[model samples]
Target: MDKQIETELEAAAFRGLLTHLQNHPEVQNIELMILADFCRNCLAKWYAEAAKERGIDIDYEQARDKVYGMPYAEWKDKYQLTATPEQMAAYEKRQKEKQ
Candidate 1:
């Protein structure tokens, strides 16, 4: 495929992923970290970094709002759950394995 088509397809895929995540608030960030080694926050950071590379100035918070479909604080208050000890242990083990 050509570059433009590739870019459009990738952008569509990203939007789909963001929508899926926004709809599935029960999937905690910690679980994402343990299973995929990345989370919504990581996506926000990457979004910010990508904007910077393109000479845009999207800050982290702005990127987060876009990825999360709401302010991070509001999302946390409404959806984020306290991690269980088992979840924490799994996350820690994943971190160790990555090293």
Candidate 2:
């Protein structure tokens, strides 16, 4: 495929992922960190970086709001759950494995 078409397809896929994540509020960021080593926060950071690369000014919080479909604090208050012991252990193990 050409570059333009490829970029559009990639953008569409990203939107789909964002929509899926928004629909699944039960999927905690910690769980994403443990399993995929990235979460919505990471996506927000990446989004910010991309904006910077294109000479756009987007802060992390702004990018996070776009990713979360709301302010991060509000989303956290509404959807974030305390991690279980098992989840913590897995997260720790994943961190260790990364280093």
TM-score, predicted candidate 1 vs. hidden true structure: 0.99
Spell out the clash pairs found in candidate 1: none
Per-residue lDDT for 12-80 in model 1, tens only?
Answer: 999999999999999999999999999999999999999999999899999999999999999999999
lDDT of 2 by residue, 1-99 (tens): 899999999999999999999999999999999999999999999999999999999999999999999999999999999999999999999999999
List RMSD in Å for every model shown: 0.4, 0.6
- In model 1, state the lDDT of residue 89: 99
Per-model TM-score, in order, reads 0.99, 0.97
Best by lDDT: 1
lDDT of each: 0.98, 0.97
